[model samples]
Target: MSSDRTASHLARNLAALRHARTLTQQELARAAAVPRSTIANLESGEGNPSLAVLVKVAGALSVPIDELLAAPRALVRHWPADAIAPRHKGRGVQVRDLVPEPVPDEMMELMDFEPGAVMGGTPHLPGTREFFTCLDGRVILMVAGDRYELAPGEVLAFPGNLPHSYQNADALQRARGVSVVVLAKAGV
Candidate 1:
C-alpha cells in the first residue's frame, strides 16, 4: 500500500484499538513508552512513525504490527456459537461473549444460570450501565442492596459500577438471560 494509505490505516486502527481497550492517548503512550504527543500525532494521521515506534505500540496494544496497517474490515462478520467459548463462573453459571472482539464502550454477553446458581457482576468504570433481560425461566438480581425478582421477558437496568449479582430463582430449572454493558467514555 502507498505510504499515505498505510498511514491512514494505522491511524484508524490505532484509534479503534485504543478505544476498545479503554485507554486514553496518555495511558497508551505510557504503556508503549512513547511520547504522548506522538500518540496524538499518529492518531491524527500526521506522523511517519518509525518501525521501532510501531513495534512498541503494537506490543502495548497486544496486537500484531500487520493489524495496525491492515485495511478496514468488512462491516458484517459472523461468529459461530461453537466457536465462542463459555466462561464458567461460580457454581453453575456460564457466560459467553456475544461479540468476536471487544467493541468500543460496549459488551454483550449470554448468561446461563443452572438451578441454584449465582454469579457476581463485574463492575466497570464509573458511569457504566448494565441491562439484563431474562429470556427464559427466572432470575433474581441483587443490586445496590436491593433484590429484584425477574421473570421471563422482564428487563432490569442498573448502574454497572455498583455491586450486583444474579441468581437462578428456581431450584429445578435453568435460567437464561442476556446482559448488555455500556462502558463510560474515557475523560467523560
Candidate 2:
C-alpha cells in the first residue's frame, strides 16, 4: 500500500482498537506516551506519525505493528485477477493478495515461482503464524532454521514471526502456492 493509504488505515485501526479497549484519546495518549492531540490527529488521519509514535501505540495496544498498520479490508469483497496488483514481482517470482483488504486476524496471498526462485528473509510480528499450501509443482517453506518440503496439495503451518522463506524445490520447473498469514490477537 502507498504511504498515504497506510496512514489512513492506521488511523482507522487505531481509533477502532482504542475504542474496543475502552480507552479514551487521552488514555491512549498517556499509555502510548504521546500527546493527546497526537492521538486525536492520528484518529483523524491527518498526519504522518513517526515510527516511534507508531511503535509506542502498537505496544500500548498489545498488537503487532503489522496488524495495527495493515490496510483494513471489508468483511466481504472480491477482486478479479487482472484488477489485483502483485504484492511482489521479480525474476521468476510473483505474489498477489488473494483478498482485497488486509484482515486484522489474517491475510492470504497467492504465489508463483519458477525453478530457483527464492523469496526470503521476511518475518511478521512476533506470535504470528502462517500456513502454506502448495497447489502445483513443488516448493520448500522454511521457517526459522528448518526447511519443510511440500508437494502439490501439501500444507505446512509454522510461526511466521521468525525469519521465513519460500522457494521452488525443483531447479527446472515451476511452483505455485497459497499462503495464509494468521495474525495473533487477544483471547484467540
Candidate 1 accuracy as TM-score: 0.65
For 18-94, candidate 2 gives per-residue lDDT tens digits of 88778899988987899999999888888788889889998888788887788776534566778988866556889
Best by lDDT: 1
Candidate 1 lDDT, 1-188, residue by residue in tens: 79899889999999998997889999999889999999999999998999999999998887889999899996466778888999997689999997777565689999999999999998888999999999999999999999999999999999999999999999999999999999997678
Q: Which stretches of candidate 2 lie over 4 Å from their true place?
A: 1-78, 89-91, 186-188
TM-score of 2: 0.56
Pairs in steric clash, model 2: none
lDDT of each: 0.92, 0.84
Candidate 1, residue 183: Cα displacement in angstroms equals 2.9
Note the clash tally of each candidate. Answer: 0, 0
On the 0 to 100 scale, the lDDT of residue 10 in model 1 is 92
